[model samples]
Target: MEQFSTMFLSFIDTWGYVAVAVLMGLENACIPIPSELILGFAGYLISAGRMEFFHATVAGMIGGMVGSIVTYYVGSHGGRPFIDRYGKYFFMKKSHVDTAQRWFDKYGVKAVFFSRILPVVRTFISLPAGFARVNMKKFIIYTFLGSLPWTMFILYIGWLLGDNWKSMLAVGHEASLIVATLIVLICLFYFIRYKRNKKRL
Candidate 1:
């Protein structure tokens, strides 16, 4: 973890805001790049007078939007077919896709907006939205709105931590686990209820 942090810090230090945008973009693209490290270090730099706060946040947002747009298109175009054909390899099953579809159908706007704030869910929410074929305009608008606060929040946490920004990485990791577990539990509860109702009928 320290190695990844050092690597991202070096890149951001060398490339400035460009690094922030690119790193955040890759992260939102569902790549394994950690936004906590990227924004946290940027916040630390802002404290050091190395980077401007507004500029860094904007760059992060732009990168995040660009990456998410790319993934959205990937899902809109070929995500469902790919998942249907070869999802098992990636640990994504058809039932997972169907669940995403149901969520989007029932709460498309809220799902897109709030999912952007959730840790693990935020990362892949765009793909599901794409699968649902949500309106392009609405998708872009909600995505941008959702991501802006989150970008600011993460950057602020990093800024507050300053030299100790690395500490937040552990917090981010744990938060992700918690969110993932809650989602799984909720899904299981619904599945069991659906089964019981079906048997009653």
Candidate 2:
């Protein structure tokens, strides 16, 4: 954990917007880089008069699009077998993949937009959307729309808490754990509900 914080802080300090962009993009690629940390730190930077919130948000959005594009293509061309094989490498389970597909089927393009606001679910959502061959234009549009607001909201949190930047590493670690737990619980609940629905059918 100390090593991670050290590395992350070094990256943020040295690369600034570039670091934020790359981190956010990597997050989309299922690399476990939390958007919350990046946005929050960026917000803290803004409050410290180090960066503008608009620039930080835009950087995050662009990074997200690039990362999701990679996942989308992987889904579009890689097929189910490919996903099954590599899913674990990216911390994705087959059940999660299926759930994303179910949501995509049920909600169409809108799922792409809403999923961006979710935590762990967002990481795998684009893959199913790509697999389902959602309209490329619509997919990009919705993804941007959904992710942009989230990016801003998180950044705002950091901005509001700028005085605590020195201790952000610890705070971020705890916040991340909490958010991850919540996301897992949400997914579990939905998974059980879906299974019940399927059984009833």
Candidate 3:
């Protein structure tokens, strides 16, 4: 993990905020880059006085918005036909999409904010939001607001850990697993209840 940390740290150190923005944008665009690593390393740079905390954080947030906007437009343009043709390849399940849409329906704007921080949910939640034709201004606002805490959190870990930022791999993974498991359990509970309710009808 140190190897990966070093790599991303190099990018941030060498290219400064540009690296943070580009890589963060790619991550939010679902490009498989880990934000924990990116923001964490930037945090480490802050400790070393290699980067400023505010600048790094802002770049990350902006980049995330940029990537999310791109992804949002893709889904908005694609709609159901796009999902029908390519959903599986994107790791999207109809049940999950339905749940997202339903949640968005009930919660309105808060769903976007919450989704931005919920592990795997954050990545693909935008698709359903876009598919449901959510208001663009509200979507953008909520998405950015939701992402700020997460970015600050991971980066804060990096800042505190200094050279030991590599240690975050274990810490982050363990925390993420616990959160993800809880989310899965909650979803399963609701799913089962819905099934029973449907049967009763």
Candidate 4:
């Protein structure tokens, strides 16, 4: 972990905003790279006057959108058949696809929006949304809205920590889990309400 962080930090240091975009894109593309580490360090640089916060945030957001669109396209273009045939190779199961589909069906495009704030879920939500062929305009809009606040929040946290931004590497994980749990609860509540309303109708 330490070694990877060091290398990632170095890459960001050398490439500036481009590195931020690329790394954030990879993370959103369902890669295991953590956004907290990326944006947190970028915040650290902002503190040191090495980078601007606005530019950094925009770069990260754009990268995330692009990456998500790519995945969404893949999912739209026969992602289900591919998964059915060879998902085992990558440890991706049909259940995963089903869950995402259910969420999209139940909550509509809002699932795409809410899922963007989640850690692991955010990385792959696009695929299912794509598979469902959710309206592309709404998908992109909600995706941008959802990612903006998250990017800013992490960047601000990093900036606040300044020289201590590295601490977020650990703290951010715990915080995200807490946030994710709360979101799940909220979604459950809405799901129940929707079911009740449907029955009444």
Best by lDDT: 4
lDDT of each: 0.80, 0.79, 0.78, 0.83
List, residue by residue over 1-201, the lDDT tens digit for candidate 4: 779878989999999999999989887766667899999999999999999999999999988999899878878896778767865665455666666667777887898988777656677788788888889999999899778778887888899999999788777657576556766787799999999999999
Please give me the total number of clashing residue pairs in predicted model 4. Answer: 0
lDDT for each residue of candidate 1 in 11-127, tens digit (9 for 90 to 100): 999999999999999888776677888998999999888998999999999999999898788788887777578656644446645655666677776688767766656777777
10 residues in a row with least lDDT, candidate 1: 175-184
Over 1-201, each residue of candidate 3 has an lDDT whose tens digit, in order, gives 558657776887899899999989877765656788788788889999988889998999999999888777877899967876787785566666666667667777678887776655566677767777778999899898778877887788889999998787657656455544655687799999999999999
Cα misplacement distance, residue 66 of candidate 3 (Å): 0.7
TM-scores, all candidates, are 0.76, 0.77, 0.73, 0.79
Q: Rank the candidates by lDDT, best first.
A: 4, 1, 2, 3
Clash pairs, model 2 backbone: none
Model 1 lDDT at residue 187: 68
Residue 131 displacement in candidate 4 (angstroms): 0.5
The runs of at least 3 residues in candidate 3 whose Cα sits more than 4 Å from the true structure, single-residue gaps closed, are 1-9, 83-108, 173-201
Clashing pairs in 1: none
Give the better candidate number (3 or 4) by lDDT: 4
The alpha-carbon deviation from the true structure for residue 134 of candidate 1, after best TM-score superposition, in angstroms, is 0.8
Q: In candidate 1, which residue ranges exceed 4 Å CA deviation? A: 83-106, 173-201
Q: What lDDT score goes with residue 193 in model 4?
A: 100
